[model samples]
Target: MLYGLIICTITVIIMSTVNIGLEFGKLDTEVFLIILKSFPIILIIAMLLEVLVIGRIAEKLVHTFSDNTDGFNAKILFTIFFTVIGMSLIMTVIGGMLGKGISPDSFGSLSHWPRNFSIALFCELLIAQPPARFVMKKLHLRQEDKLDYDFD
Candidate 1:
């Protein structure tokens, strides 16, 4: 939950900001408000998709591509790569629909996927996952520190 929440928070914020900028062609108070208004639904959808769809697929891809000899970073990189790809591809269409509703624009949203995918992939790799994983590691270590070592 921690990892998911962190990842989703970063992803949603950055993605929403960029998307709103692109849509509005300017980032004013009004556009920022629009981003805020649209954020909750998008965040919820992204979380559900991450857990139910992207997470599982990324795990499988990591296992398939990573060897036992691979370092932790290698596995993590693979997971991040796969996860970003899956999320970006799915979310691009969903975002378009959410913004434009059920219309030709929404249906034509696929054209934007390349740009969206690039942004998502860049942010997830360089921005979101590192902080999320760092926080998870810190919490894991903290929890371990608190564990009762009662081995007699």
Candidate 2:
């Protein structure tokens, strides 16, 4: 859960900025203001979508692939893969909708969704995960606590 929150927050921020820049061509003062103003709402929507929708879907995918017997690295890779896919899809749609609401000319079409998705996937896998994992490790949030149960 903590991991999910960290990843979702980081990915949302990066993806939102990148998508905004892609739509507007550059991040000038006006664009930055748009970002600053819209950020809170965007983040809220993203986190809700991630936690309530994507996380459940990713967990189901993960369980289908692994029986909880894989090594930690394998599990992490699976989680990251599923998460990147889930986040990219959800964010692309939501961003497009919000962008359209903000400026019809700027985000006029969904033609750029593929490009946006690729950039998001690449960033999540290559850029975001390393630091997020580091932070989780430092905070002792990476390790799962196993509970032993006995019936007599």
- Point to the candidate with the largest lDDT: 1
Instruction: Give the Å error, residue 99, model 1.
Output: 0.5
lDDT of 2: 0.73
Residue pairs clashing in model 2 are: none
**How close to the true structure is residue 132 of candidate 2, measured as C-alpha lDDT?**
76
TM of each candidate vs. truth: 0.91, 0.77
Cα error, residue 12 of model 1, in Å, equals 0.8
List where candidate 1 sits over 4 angstroms from the true fold.
148-152
The residue-by-residue lDDT of candidate 2 on 16-71, one tens digit each, is 77778877999899988888887888778877877788778888898899876798
Q: Tell me the lDDT of model 1 at 110.
A: 83
TM-score of 2: 0.77
